[model samples]
Target: MYKNSIKILGAYGTKAKGFGTTSFMLNRHTVIDAGNLLDALAEDSLHIENIYLTHSHLDHISDIAYIIDNYFCKRSKTLNIIGLPQTIQALKEHFLNDIIWPDFSKIPLENSDVIAVKYSELYLNEEYHLDKQTTLTPVRTDHTVPSCGYIYKVNNAGVLITADTFSLENIINTVNNDMQIKSLVVECSFSSNMQTLAEVSKHLTPKLLFQALKKLKRDDITLYINHIKPSCLEEISTEIEAFRGNFKPIILKDGDFITF
Candidate 1:
């Protein structure tokens, strides 16, 4: 009877007029990334209690500043910003150091002793309980910066989200070892024509994605593709369509919801 749901707030690798960058809300309290969160959640953004960041990239952590600033006075509780040690350090030093954006972690909220923000550092492969039925485990990912993907388990059912990775070896092995993983949300940021850029940026092209998927032993799991660049969406879509594999990959849109 354990239920879990994920709403895709933003699925693109880059933002445009109609497209947004990577962000997903797990149930109502927890969000997987911060990109486009403000735009997608609007006033409902105040409901977010925790943000589990995948990396220190701007596209993944941009909304952290806005959310704290916008809801500064109204917030009753502190917002928990969870991520790896390096990721947290990067955010503190570069993004929210009071030079670029105010460090809300040190600033107190209106008429309260509670601070506006709090930082929690998570270790790789360690399981953190989200609720009585849900837990999140961070696994390593191949990215330009220090990054990792998350495996969210709700009772016996689980979903693996590969956040902006170039290699799939670690994720495939994680899936093979963990029996609970029943779904995957992977990223494909470029078309096959831009394979060089994909490699340099440590993101996946459609061809690269297929090559990685071929290594996955499970066939019953749902494969959800996301983080596509808007300019190359058409080309990536065509390439993904041409890729005939055991599991058909579904390109996730901003508002798509999946339950498990």
Candidate 2:
């Protein structure tokens, strides 16, 4: 029913008891990450055409295993899993190697001509057109492992999502230069007390995030914060509240919808 669209399937900073990890559905057909794709989506909605993964982190790619298994019978064609070269390599060598999980790429589909999964290579800063209206570009991010954020632009609505990152320079530069960037979704995973851990893990805490924001040149951008560790949510919120900045980041939970 959505024409020019927006939707959020899962938005918890991290999974709580009954909740799931970080996966966000765009237009109900495209996935930002596969963290909790199966758990968060209904059977009908799980018939996604493309899954754009930010990185190969467990929490980022967790539900990829389940979706392929449960929906194998229903998938009409090869499910396109797109990411950077390193991300695709990691998935092949580590996650879907048949040792950890069954390689869906090797499995045959009911009616399709070939395999169930396809690993597509994407380079950092390269923009690919998904359709006439939608485009996605990956921007490199600083993480413990190889990671990249995504810029999804549909017509005039632009969403800049930093899946898991600590580096602000690259993101700042991109956001500052792109006039189409209207909304930003960033992560803050720890409190000020855990700033050291956040740094070591290449994540952002409220303190570090503030310091990172100093690199950006704009204040009019709408900021939506995600990836807050459940345990330290309160402390991180308090710290971010005291952050004296022009760009106020609004915390988002699971199932929140954003419209441009």
Candidate 3:
């Protein structure tokens, strides 16, 4: 692993027998999403204090309930769940509303006075310093649900994450304008043959993805691709190779490290 890198804990669009869903580990104490925390880190998941969510989707937020449930008695620090306003609301209303999963926000840890979970809302393009060395900024993205991508920086170097989106307009402009961002993690979720379904679901196919990247004015930025549907992996990989013109995008996998 590099000294400065975003570890790919889970790099698939959906779960399979072996593949994990979306998640990225920023540091020992922080992660970008909760999809595969328990599976990736096991008891070390107890060290996680923050989860910066991209959206309210199941594949992105599934492990939140399990992580809290697994470490409820062992955890002392509150698990801070941060995201956009609507993302927070959706987690509270539909997912963790006490009907499906226990609302850990209301429950205190056995060892500490702090609640098991906490929520923080994000505003787009505003930078929030998480610690002395790290700053994260949210950016808008086009998805079926209200979602936001993240630009995480450390030591003045940064990586942009476009979690799950169909549109690359904001992404291209962001990378072109933000010199701090040296790497971009984009999603390519479907094959070229499934263009209609990808469009309808607000995901990107290889054909659409490269076609959109044709508008990217910068060539210095490294492109990393993720969130590939397990079923379409082979087909999508082939299409990506065929269509990715001058952009050499490395397809990401579980446990990969993306250094900015």
Candidate 4:
């Protein structure tokens, strides 16, 4: 059961033959992103009540439409889509616009009073408690768009999740300032040779990733890598091993669990 641990529903940067995109199940009802919810949880996905988005990128939101499409009739509650103000605007104006996908925020659920989806704009750096024990704080991140990652704290320990960031400036400062952070989910989406592409896309290659991590003051934190573009997985993995310096990172897979 993933009652205490954060379950990685999808891990890769983009879809491949077998891999899915970004999604993390924090508990039965709370999730981080909507990249692969339907495929990962199937009918169990119906239990998901809130989807906290990092950004409005397609790879991170592909399943938001499918989850509603598949379970609209069975859903007993509204799907609360939470994110930064800009993130919510993108979802509403572009992603869930009637042409792209049905604006579920306006559509009521079958035989229910609640709408199919509800979008909540979260303030960056404010701590929101999912329950008495779990608190999620959205922090700024460097991406092509206005994106932000989260600091998930439970039982006083936390994990910093950098969903699709290019620069580690904001993340490093947050981690150093917060005593609760014990681990990190950093994305390395390209290989060292693809530096130009990585920067342009606001992603990271192993060389850039590790070079930035050197500034982190806390050396005891466990590093977990995710969001790797499948095509360059092998090359990036090899580069991570070569340049990781002192932090031996565990490369995350779709079914992985991150226990804080």
> Which segments of model 4 are wrong by more than 4 Å?
none
Candidate 3 lDDT tens digits, 1-260: 55479899999999998899999999899999888998899889999999999999999999999999988999999999999999999999998899999988999999999989999998999999988888999999999999989999998899999999999999889999989899999999989888899989999999999889988888899999999999999999989899988889999999999987
Model 1 root-mean-square deviation: 1.4
Model 3 superposed RMSD (Cα): 0.9
lDDT of 4 by residue, 127-211 (tens): 9999998899999999999999999988889999999999999999999998889999999999999899998999999999989
Select the stronger candidate by lDDT from 1 and 3. Answer: 3
lDDT of each: 0.90, 0.82, 0.92, 0.92
lDDT of 2 by residue, 19-91 (tens): 5678877755688887777666768545787889988888888878888888887778678899888999999
Question: How many clashes show up in model 1?
Answer: 0
lDDT string, candidate 1, 1-260, tens digits: 12577889999998899887899898677899999888998988988989999999998988888998988888878899999999999999999999999988898889578988999999999999988988999999999999999999888699999999999999999998877998999999988988999999999988888877787887778889999999999999999988846668889989888676
Q: What TM-score does each of the candidates earn?
A: 0.97, 0.94, 0.98, 0.98
Q: Candidate 1 or 2, higher lDDT?
A: 1
What value of lDDT does candidate 3 attain over all alpha carbons? 0.92
